[model samples]
Target: MSMTPIVLDARTLKALAHPLRVQVVGTLRRFGPSTATQLAERLGVSSAAVSYHVRQLAAAGLVVDVPERGNARERWWKAAHDVTVADTRTLDEDDPDALDAYLRSIATAITLRIQQVLGARSAMPPEWRSVTDLSDFRARLTPAQTEELTERLHAVAEEYVRQHPESEAGPDAEMVSFDLQVLPDLDVGDRS
Candidate 1:
């Protein structure tokens, strides 16, 4: 049940720069095939708007119509990949605008997701709350070390997923999002 991840190229990244477009793809991927109406209902956007954005995503090859699941009245759309990944380290000055826009959109998405969990933490059962984390670590490391750490962390996560794919998860399993970011402080100024 593991789908391939889409590594962002400049064109696809630009297409996903819009926050809503990015959200549409993520929603379909996370929730499964859905029509524009269903997606709009979940995302609080108009069906027309969602349809338009879905078209844009389709054009960029990030999403596709699930014709088998669709009816004559509405088309079902799903993400072409389960994950969207970008290498911000490769971003240079040539197209800072698009790169920054895409980065901001992702940051906003992550922030909103974390906030939703935080907002609902009080109502969550003790077991779930106990497993939630909202903490950070500070360390002094070279750029190469930071990059290595990032790779190791991501590998560990990927290995875990391979071992525990969704199809095999039991009834007790929950859909979890593991958001990991390894960012270096640019302005240490003796205090980080």
Candidate 2:
């Protein structure tokens, strides 16, 4: 499967503002095609709830039905793309409120994932725990340089995924989440 990133627009960003929708899309991206019942079980929600959220995601063009994997009674859903790139720079400058809301939604989702990882850290194997990282680095660069750095980092990540396709990996290989955030420090004066 080709894992291309989907660039989200204003409308899709608004649609993904909901927490459940974010989780539904993330689940599909990580687990491949799954039915509402399977998603419900994994997410600890009801099948009906998953089905409803799946429909909302489909309407937003974030996910689609995998008819080839489903029967008459059940519908399988999969993410339309592997990665979601939300470029706040593309948002309308007049609609600062929308941009703020979208950023908040993204922050909430990231916080949730961080909490989940921290909560499960003790359960992870010794090797995995040793490799897990949480760090902060500050850098000064021009806008163009920032863009170039982000592009290079994304390309390296994509190359890694292409080389280590999960489908071809061994059973012992675990799913590792890599979250990257690069932003200018708003409180530059406060930095020590």
Candidate 3:
């Protein structure tokens, strides 16, 4: 079955603005249902801290308690959806601050993830390193064309991910991360 991507609103975005909350949501998506203690061990944080962030994520509708996975004393949390879609165009025009917060939070999370991967790159095996890549491409297109390109690229990624779910990763299968960003080159017109 195909999972629908959650469309984030200003309120949900604000709730996910915290770094830990963002990490918690990512962890749930990557690792499946887990308790705060398990998440703490994976994140190298305290259980209380993980629990706090989990609550925030739950409140934001990004996560849900997996009651069947844990006893009453221990709560398990899972990501509400497999994918999260954020379109700045959907943001409320009257609330620019919320949009700014959401963008900053997303930027910080992506930057941190990239840094973490780079830090561990040297420790990875040769086979793993061979498949890793970091590249940039420039494109000149109108806003409509850019949106279409983004949708096409997203469809490709989504199809690949659906075929190979993250939860199915095994000993030999490593978690791969992909970041795709397409933006206009404002400097192109300005020689300065």
Candidate 4:
């Protein structure tokens, strides 16, 4: 079955408000499938708590149980989506507080994960860390140029995925994360 993409309504957003749940979802998205025991071990939580949260996620339609092959007793679960989101503007205008909280939570979770990942891998492969500096610049462009640029960037990502299809998640392959968020840069003076 095709994975169901997660679109956060107010309720689902509230459901994922917890940091652990966000981490759990990210883990599932990265690892493909994991049992509660595995998650508990990874997160340093009890299996029972992991099981309970897994059920909550399943009930929220964010995750689903996948049948295990050759292991009848193992309970394997997979994320319902390859992509999950928290765009509350799609829900309603008056719920900015919920959206803000969701964004902050996701950002915090991602930042923590990045710190852990980078710290654990003291030396990244040359290819992965060849460029330690970020190149950030602003440009003035017509609407068409902006649209074309966005589409081209998206195409590059799609091509990358097509060329290097994700293998089954395991110890040999690490999940790398990329996050791009566009918001007003408060520290920067108005460029316009």
Give the candidate number with the greatest TM-score.
1
1-192 per-residue lDDT for model 3 (tens digits): 477589888778787777777778888888889999999998889999998888888888899998888896898889998777776776757467777776677777788888888899899899988888888888778789999999999889878888887567677987778978787886898444
lDDT of 4: 0.72
Q: lDDT score, residue 76, model 1?
A: 95
| Higher-lDDT candidate of 2 and 3 | 2
Whichever of 1 and 4 has more TM-score, that candidate is 1
**Residue 178 lDDT (model 4):** 55
Off by over 4 Å in 3: 92-94, 165-173, 189-192
| Model 2 score (lDDT) | 0.83
Error of 3 at 122 (Å): 2.3
Ranking by TM-score: 1, 3, 2, 4
Regions more than 4 Å wrong, model 1: 89-94
**lDDT (C-alpha, whole model) for all candidates:** 0.86, 0.83, 0.82, 0.72
Off by over 4 Å in 4: 1-4, 67-74, 92-94, 131-156, 167-175, 188-192
Residues 98-148 of candidate 2 have per-residue lDDT tens digits of: 667767766777788889889999999999899999998878888899999
Instruction: Name the TM-score of candidate 2.
Output: 0.81
